[model samples]
Target: MMNALAKQSTVLDLIDEYDRKAAGVEDAIKAYDDACTAIEMAGTIMGTYVNPVLRGKAYVHAREMQKNLLSSGWKAIYSRLNIDMIASARDKKLFERTLADPPPLTFENAKATFGPYLENPRSHILRGLAETFAALDPAYKSHSKVKIGVKGLPKRVILSSFGDYSGTYGRDKLRDIVNALASYRGQPLMEHVEFNAISVAHRRGDDAILDGRVYVAPERYGKADEYQTLDRGLTIRLFGNGNAHVFFAPETLKDINRALAEFYGEVLPDAEEEGAKPRTGTAVSKDLQFYWSPQDVIDRALEFAGIIDLKEWRNNSPEPSRILEPSCGDGRIMDGIRARGHRAFGIEYHAGRAAEARAKGHSVLKANFLDCPAKPEYDLVVMNPPFYGRHYVKHIRHALQFLKPGGTLVSILPATAHYDHGELKGEWRDLPVGSFAEAGTNVPTGLLKIRTPSPSTQRATSW
Candidate 1:
């Protein structure tokens, strides 16, 4: 009888496994059908029934704005914004699917949504902050920094940075950090720490010499290259023989000790204890929020322009070339261009983000793209241009002016603008991309590949 019972258990386990696999297949099929059908329908109604291109662009940009609002304030703003977008779309099929696959959320399992801004150095400087979070908050885990909106208040920043490259480079790379007084936003995270100038040694013709190799990264967002404005330039440099040299700031020692203390207080509270509490979006909690990651727009641009094949790029576009993005947000598209080992430049409208972009080792400016003068020469144009603008007519016309004859204009625009707007007349090959509504978390649901013809071939189509 016992052997018979064991055999019964094995059979039941197999049955469960088979059931899961079957469900997975079903979801995949449903998503594929939904996306493909939606794309076909969008093409048919470019000017009439459904302008998915417009709706898709609206969703992506709105999500970016939502992220900004939440960071300026708390969770409710981010939560309500995304939920409202879903509601507004009223995609009956999408709503039903979401209900079927309700997110497994929990405060204990939640993580902040950092998006693609991870390529920046400020992203790295937040390591110490996360260490502190583990020490101070029991429910928090390793997650991206996010902003949330609070009621009766404008907005507020919560969460901390996700480890990026800032920490590796020292003070210059880190943009946001608390100052030496253990202060943040001109307030104190602590009273103080003892400061003393100690001898940092290095070999000098076999004799050790003293050098000041000390610095402190902020506990939060603080600009380093722009430190003069804050009057917080604390790092010092020491030069040596044989052209040998080093740079250091003193606050780093104190910062290390603080992190060590926090680490002990928090991360070690329940050490050596691990159990499966449902890992992948499986927890049920109130605080877990939706996360959005941006696309590799720059890389997509290369493929869209037919500059190189999709699988292998650097080898194909290795020739010294110029690349540009008009509305680059946090270097997502710009970084892609840089990866191809080409000279790249981008224009962004937000001041703080422009600075943030520069801090991430990018050549960026805080200026409206439309106001900027065109360079009149670039090999390729890769942009997911802003959809909400009438003045964009001039912006696109100017951007196109910069491109050399035969240069590619790989962009994402609302299909409605492709029809209704009084701009963008050219011999264009539209590569119709379907919505990843059910697949891509936060993304351009659809894409149009635009090509600008030579002056002689251009026709002025009245809109």
Candidate 2:
């Protein structure tokens, strides 16, 4: 009887220890919840500041907090917790459905959308900030240091420097980024002030170092670099080492962040979906009407025509040939032909494009080549015709009529045209893929060369 009583007592002691550990775990969880609440409250307060200096300081602090949280492996922890919660739910299917159909504008959704931007240093948002800073500060040169001053803002903020060569940002490359940022204006995004700076750097052994530290004058903040005053009430200054100082109202910062999140998460996806739908009739006609050939493609087509020897054309030895371009939008091919010392003429269907070509000093007629009578007047014919619905076949056949008996015809046609139109005799060379991507199209193209039958061959065939 004593052994049984001792065993019961031992079991009770073990239960008591387990209860104590459970209580400790609950307390830890409560403390964690409290800390998160405090952080959220802090963020809310920081975002409400109106003073530029205070807002800037708050922005810096928030960024530091974000860096710390991300570095502490919170992402992995959150991911694991998310999975465990869904897996352990009373109804797993319902939990998954709820996650999939989250409230569109809720804080949780916004956080999920913008979380990757905060974590990635080279994200589009950060790069946009860098470019805006570079555009505002004229004194900001790549791999240099310069003082930046805001007219209304009094505080001088020093940005952290980058340590390596790969960290540098060039001013020339910021043009496209600046243009993209400008395009965001009036779209629920905040726009603002202008600031400029200039500085030089010297190479020290294998490292590039700024000549002097950035200095802001106490009175009037020094002379302004040639900059137009903007009314947006925000200023950004950049260093060549990719550090940037941004000054704006805290509310504006929130608005910009929210706008960007919406733009990336919703607007862009909708646009892509709209573009994915197949086009019919006029839509297809407008989209496929023109895809200008790149200069390299033009040179290759000229080489295939056997008019001017590409190697000795520059030496003024090879005789220049007369060339005609049909459907020459803006006369780019004509310019190439002229550059190679060839006599070039063009026929354009678009009035505005013909005027543009004429303005460039090229002889272009505002008429369709198909309507014009082919006189077999040209020594060589080079054209990049419309590639829609095998339209290139009609254009190629008509262009051949303009070629002399011994003259060659070179046309930039779709690669599939070579296989589809086996009736047309020619030497087809496939152009590199994505050759027209810079011109806003990705249609695979090939250069087709065909020579007219000379008098001797015609007579022999007639016999």
Candidate 3:
């Protein structure tokens, strides 16, 4: 009986001490609230004063005092609770919910509720505080309004700012959409458009500004696609993060929508009756013979070889040189070469394509490039060979034999070809995804630029 009475007495003493401490905590909280109110009132009065110098000095002093108070108070609270001052988004949300209608303010309850936050606090506490403030204060809640115009975009093209929407189209459909647009616009649209990653910020009064860099192509084509910058006319910006922005002249909006809708299915509400139908083309075959390199891609390959510059080649007088394209189908690469005032020679196995090249005033041999003699005569050899299986490797290796010592060979091959060709030494650049969409293939491709070793360098290595 005596031991039990002693235990009861100890419990009573603890309860008493707890009550007293709780009372002290309440009083301190009230004092802090009063101090904050007093500081705010003083600052407001100082702002109204006519003397700018005195007001400025007072503001500085008050800000410093407030900062010190907040820092000290937060530190004390964190130390007392044995909890971190920071919290992750999930933990912060949990904290907010717990604080909204908290249980009796007890240590056990706090520990139970914020156990996860105490374990890991990855984000700053100020963000949670700002959110809380925004909830309570109208001024804090006020944000700049953002309006994105999407009526000019295709109906199938989804728009998202805060990542709330999943797109309706898959990558293949998206590529087809871009290809359709390119056909309608009668130019390479992939190089001019941006796709599959975007960030938006508020500009002034209902306007949102999007800022992002050009999408560099990946090594192997995945479900994601990338678009480049278009300087003239319409600019379409699409992000992989499900954000999209389309900027165009008011007059061009109709044409732009029509172009996108050609492959995206549904036309805009205000589209004309002569709306575009979905593009139909020959499907990609296993042989990969139908893949025609886009002019932009061909130009990029030539540029990689230093044979021509897309920007200045037309303006500057051409330095006549011999460039070769093996298995050049329809003379697309040859056309790019001749446009730069270089003599373009092609070896084509297809009689029709060879005839077409000849029709374009290009000197093309109507024979198999592999069967042709390997002569170190050309200054540059630029070609897009067959991509089926390991045929590209064979073509690239054979093409090297035609390069003069110190001559560069630029070829477009499968993205994985670089890895496959362990014996060949070259620099590889990934072409953008959907680069060959208009060419009847979506296989990811890359540019390989390799230079034949000069005779002196070869001799030194041989020694």
- Using lDDT as the measure, the top candidate is 3
Rank the candidate models, highest lDDT first: 3, 2, 1
Q: Candidate 2: list runs displaced more than 4 Å.
A: 1-288, 309-318
Off by over 4 Å in 3: 1-288, 309-318, 419-423
Model 3, range 1-463, lDDT digits (tens) per residue?
4555544333234334444655565465567667665765675664464433323322224334434443343333334443433442334346445543445434454456555455633212322322322222222211110012344232223335423255443333333333333334444434324433222121111222122344534435565455444433434445557554445455444554332222222111101112323344333433234467897798789889887544465566656777889888789888888777677889888788789989989898988777888989988899887765556677888999998899899988765466443455689886754466566554456788999999999999999
Every candidate's lDDT = 0.39, 0.52, 0.54
Clashing residue pairs found in predicted model 2? 136-195, 137-196, 137-197, 138-196, 138-197, 139-197, 139-198, 140-197, 192-232
Model 3 clash pairs are 196-238, 196-239, 196-240, 197-239, 197-240
Q: Mind giving the per-residue lDDT tens digits that candidate 2 earns over 252-369?
A: 4443343323221210111111233434431122333456778889888877877564445455476677789988889898888877667789999878889999999999888877
Worst 10 residues of 3 by lDDT: 264-273
Candidate 3: deviation at residue 148, Å?
38
lDDT of 1 by residue, 1-463 (tens): 4555544323234334434544465455556667766776667844365444434432224334333332322233224333221211122224445443333222222222212122432212233343332332222221111112111110111222212221322221122222322221232221122011211211112211123233233334554211111223233222331222222233433343333222222110101112223223211111112111144433454666655433365454456567677766577666666655555677777666567668778888777787788776887777655433344455567788678765777665433344334266654432222121122211112234455566656544322
Cα lDDT of candidate 3 equals 0.54
